[model samples]
Target chain A: MTINPKAKLEETQDGTVVYNFDPLIVKSHYEIDYVHSYAQDSEFFKALGRQELMGSKCKKCGYTYGTPRGHCMECGSETEWYKLPNEGKIHAFTTCYFGGEAFLNETPFHLVLVEFEGVDSLFMSRIIGVDTEDLYVGMPIRAKFRRNLKLNPTDVYFVPKA
Target chain B: MKNKGQDVYMISGGVTKFTKASPEADFRLRTKKAFDYALNDVGMTLKDIDGSVASYFSDHFQRQLMSGIMAQDYLGLTPKPSKRVEGGGATGGLSFQAGVEEVASGRMNTCVVYGFETMSHVNTWKGNEFIALASDTNFDYPIGGFYTGYYAMMATRHMHEFGTTVEQLAKVSVKNHGNALHNPYAQSPMKITVEDVRKSPMVSYPLTRLDVCAMSDGAAVAVLANEEKAFELCDNPVLIKGIGTGTDTMRLSDRPHGKVILLPNETEADYKNLKYPGVHSFRAGRSAAKEAYQSAGITDPLEELDIVELHDAYTSSEIQTYEDLGLCKYGEGGHFVEEGKADLKGKVAVNPSGGLLACGHPVGATGIMQAVFMFWQLQRTIKKHFKDDALQISNAKRGLIHSHAGTGTYVTATIMEAVK
Candidate 1:
């Protein structure tokens, strides 16, 4: 489907069109001209609609990684990006307390290091849709993409799988 | 006659310009420089190295991946054993230990250890978020615990526990800046005074902007060789006499005990008593140094050592090390620095090469960089200006290098000797 450049634009009184492309897509293309920076979209944000989340892994060393790259951390071999199994266990976690002007969230929220099967390193994410007090070490969980109410429609949060 | 000595010795060493960030020289180029420099410094070639080790989290600093391989390819060394070890600030130090094991265990006669990080290349908030990766991601990040926060907490705790004054911490900044004046490679070479330090903007409670080491970009390399090979390679081969490392619980709350003091409005005495309170993390540095001392056959580090290069990642960390490394008695670190005992011309010259405080701590390169400074001092590659001929500590017969990971969690120490 073609995105109409004029359709997303707002007509001004002077007839100069002001386009309203999604901030996320706008960040990836032209310079924002004058807005704060943003993070690149990841697989963690891709699975919110109900499919599985996958990351690229090195074929030679079997080291799984987030966001596909051309090489591996181990074995120094050129790597091709591939989909990884989403099921992982909670390795470590923490909760935040202090708030600053830039910090968008309130009070305390859970952040976790999720370790996938057969991978040595952990994947970091916010463990939503679960009670914070109930979490523990080695908890078995799966990945779920959750729609973020506060962010744009495309924004997603990684919730824990039961 | 059979000569008996400890298992580890540095057969090669390398370095790159200490900068905030290297655009043309990323982690890969810097690693290659250090690697080639180390090999050539030891009169060897890339083909002579048998294994490779490095310190890097992810290539988040430069937006690259597989830093280890990227470095290995830079050397054109293929199919050799290569691995990456990530331990935050102690990255370089831990990689040295790994290299030592590789050579000591007879797995390889020559191993290359490299630490490369372009910490300044990333955005400030993103960099903060990346460093927070060391903390409990879920709990600490959401709670606003940053790398500065963790070190700040340590500074606050140290102040409370030992009656350590902010002036004492300022002494660390002043002394390091004074020493940097003589060092050509130091990132911040201007002289700073205690008054200057006190007036600097406070970053986290007791730690002023001057108190913390800047994020630096550089690479350091070391080549470990067996005893016989070492003898043939260099005139002054620094022996890696002993190597030891340990990890404390990563979580700040999980750490045995200590509360984070937020309000600086409290009295000075309140801060002192709360800072270090029986905290034993410095023991990690002492333990590593003790083993290094024992292996090098030294009885008194105070009188016997010629030079010392300590991992002063922060002013507070360097002060803590004075107690941990047994350079002074317990709770006497502040007094020692206040009296100029650890000054380059004092009883024992500490960080004559200006240390990480001024030279910049580029994560993995820090430990090896410490070793390189010691090697240069031992070889007289870096000139030492002495006022009195009699006061001069001549020949640098023995040198010590110490480095630690986050909040003193991991430590690596090595002893080197100058043989004419």
Candidate 2:
């Protein structure tokens, strides 16, 4: 095979030459358009803005969902929004050393699944204010909401309860 | 039991060598190679195939869509009933199941099921993002939780609940890597100690870089035929005794955790320590295995099944799958591995093909590759290619193939036996 005469060649630190016939690198960025409507639990984030954790309780089955649901998954009944206790215990947790591009700056972050005293489902959020070694399952934690935040679950965090 | 349906058998299968990098090959070339290999294995050609099932997880990598048509056109198999299948990592097995059903239903006498992924063409960051697409975008992605973190959480929970140690988890990687040393198709076959695994850089806590399977480029294809056609066309065949598939909630938060306890006499502490059944166990795997065992009439898998090929994408997954597939009792997976029950010389040899952990995970190709490995083992033709005597299980009559997709959302379990 004949090599391209116009090929660009570059030398590496190890003295190895790399050839690139097509030096033009096309860069593109695209976004996935999605309409996220929190109609079921718009109040959930609104409550988080006020530093209060909230959940939905199924009036029919008495099942409480940590992340607010519009209807009961069990009986298909309308759910009632209720303020959840800020205090909960860690159901499970993991300390991530390598966070992807989105979370690269916040390396060594702790992601915990906190189960409230009465909630049926676990609430997953980042945990702060504790040594990584000290964090254990069933450790008491309290919700801490981010100030000046928009409608997102990451707006809330948990810390070791005093 | 009532009459199930027509019997289906895997007459032949083929797989390209798993590699971390294959810059020269693309999806079409890999598919054609795997297809031709499978056809040659059975002494057939494209003209003999009546139907085809192709699986490739994301067209984004290839910048193409309608992969089934693409494969069909590239293979020059015109007018053949061809379709695509996708179920995250379980796409290959799901495609195989579809092919089996197509033949069993008498719609097609012979069919080809194949899957491939050319992930090495893309950069690692882009590949990681593409893989994250399989997760629940609304919940998992926003929380900075991808596959590694998701599995790490499960590992942590398993450690807490069952006292499973990180060393025990490392033993899985050690054992799989040791098995891969004998596999010619494996990507990384170097043997390492449990201490090496623990010393490896932590991607997510409790799970190091070595614990996760490498992203690979490869393709695997299998030919399925009805009983009569299999008996007529091939001298020896691997019968597909049973196939089962099940799914769980898409989002991790919505996974079933059993019923909520409510009693007036219960203390707050009791509720705090309330243990749910489905936390560590993969419900989808359990459900699929249950159906498979029932259909195959297998009461004791550890005792009845001679060999197994499980989806060991992460070392933790393999440990958990031991419990999910009923190879051992719940919360005994760590002990199962510690006792050497899952070794090649153990009660039930698991992942004799080096598994995804050592052989490299090409996503769509993994499940089909497992079936290909099982087919070779049962047909006793594995030694021809692998040339590893220790890799072959002794008197292997029955084998099982299990694969899970998208954080336990989908599972496919297939039981295959050697036709005496």
Candidate 3:
């Protein structure tokens, strides 16, 4: 079990400190709906074949989001496909000793919060190819895609560089 | 604090022997046990209760908007304002506030608040889903955050920032468990040590299994009445003197500056004079305690307070309360425990009836359960070292009860006095 991010802390006059430690990480993953919706858009799938990451930018709010979407979350306006910043920064992450979402591989995956440069919101995914223990806040990372045999060959999952 | 016009007083209160399991028993039965225990405590029956409020943590156990009415009907209570209040693990304490409002507002002559849970019977995952509901769903839920994760983060942060050793947090468990050994109603009354806490399996980093409150099956009930009727209906009435409640932002991310500020170090004359990282209660709890103290005319909590029954839902919560309740100075909570100032026979007895760590947490029942402990302590009813005179020496005219909702977002602090 992890600590709640909202826990309280105290510091003493003698320099003793007390607080709760909660760590969580967000990573990038292709949610089924995201892959299914973009699979129909041949041009979007072609971008992944070239190892390029893509996103949708909302015209109404100028917001760029990772998940292929019909509408923008912020302004609720129709969004058009656009290439996203290839590089991102790790916002936060947590090491899971037990349990994982069904779609995720299994327990103990390094869940990372990744914020594309200059984006207000971040996406969650697994940090691959590195010892999760060494993961820290503000680690520079880039997106990669892994194709699933069951899905289209263009399907991709983001993995942080070693 | 002047006795406000809110004249709520406990006309009756009841609690079951907090246990790990009560198979086949639903909240309705558990609540009945507590209600009957309370009704008998006051020499009255359920029929006498003019209004009722039930506190439960999740809809899973009782299920539905009218579960309060369902539980009330099971008690054979007449048509009255049967309502429900939930505040995560602090549901019990929040229920006390609900009952207090009934009498304070003069809308009802008496109000009964009941809290119960049959956790052992429910699926653990489902139970967890309910507790996770306490957080801001939109932001926290997707992160797979729950009680363990939430508290673990806090524990981790506490260790990182304040250098608060895991052992100090464990000391709270050890001491409270020791106190629980004396409490017949406690669920896990076995003795524990700081070493035991350290060796225990980690739930989240820095927090061991012992540091968490046991998920148990139990029920607690309390009845509040107007001042005049309380004196007439009950022989040993514990008068409600002060009530204070506050709410902070719900999401941690929202409080970028970290909304949690430990109560101003009371040991230092100036807020800035005191050093950080000392013995102190979390700021939110101390705020509640300060409001209670001021209302009850208490200036020195360490010197003037008698027995205390606080929310120890986690070991750290209890340790922080020492500083919050002004029982000791900053960084002195650990020393206070080691020195026995908050022990059964110590200066200001804490959790003499055991705490949530040792006793059990039934969410809505917790706040009123603390009141019940204070009631017994004030009357010297317990066969413990801290005699009834402990309150007397501390000017013994008053007692304090503290409770909070989910990681200090909401707090309820109350002071009860022995009316002559």
Which candidate ranks first by TM-score, i.e. highest? Answer: 2
Q: After TM-score superposition, what is the CA distance of residue A73 in candidate 3 from its true location, in Å?
A: 20
Using all chains and alpha carbons, the TM-scores for the candidates as numbered come to: 0.68, 0.90, 0.72
Weakest 10 consecutive residues of candidate 3 chain B by summed lDDT? B252-261
Q: Give Cα distance to truth, residue B247, candidate 1, Å.
A: 2.1
Q: Which ten residues in a row have the lowest lDDT in candidate 2 chain A?
A: A16-25
Q: How does residue B350 of candidate 3 score in lDDT? A: 78
lDDT of 3 by residue, B46-114 (tens): 566788788877666434456667788888885777778877666777778778877887888888888
- Give residue A34's error in model 2 in angstroms: 4.8
Which portions of model 1 miss their true places by more than 4 Å? A1-162, B1-6, B257-281, B384-393
Q: What does candidate 2's lDDT look like per residue over A25-142, in tens digits?
A: 3434455778987665678778878998888888898988876777888789999987889999887788888755566667788888778886787777888887678989889999
Over 4 Å off, model 3: A1-162, B1-3, B62-65, B256-283, B329-332, B383-397
Question: lDDT (0-100) at residue B343 of candidate 1?
Answer: 85
Q: Rank the candidates by DockQ, best first.
A: 2, 3, 1
Please give the lDDT score for candidate 1.
Answer: 0.65
Model 3: chain B TM-score relative to the native chain B: 0.88
DockQ, all candidates in order: 0.03, 0.34, 0.04
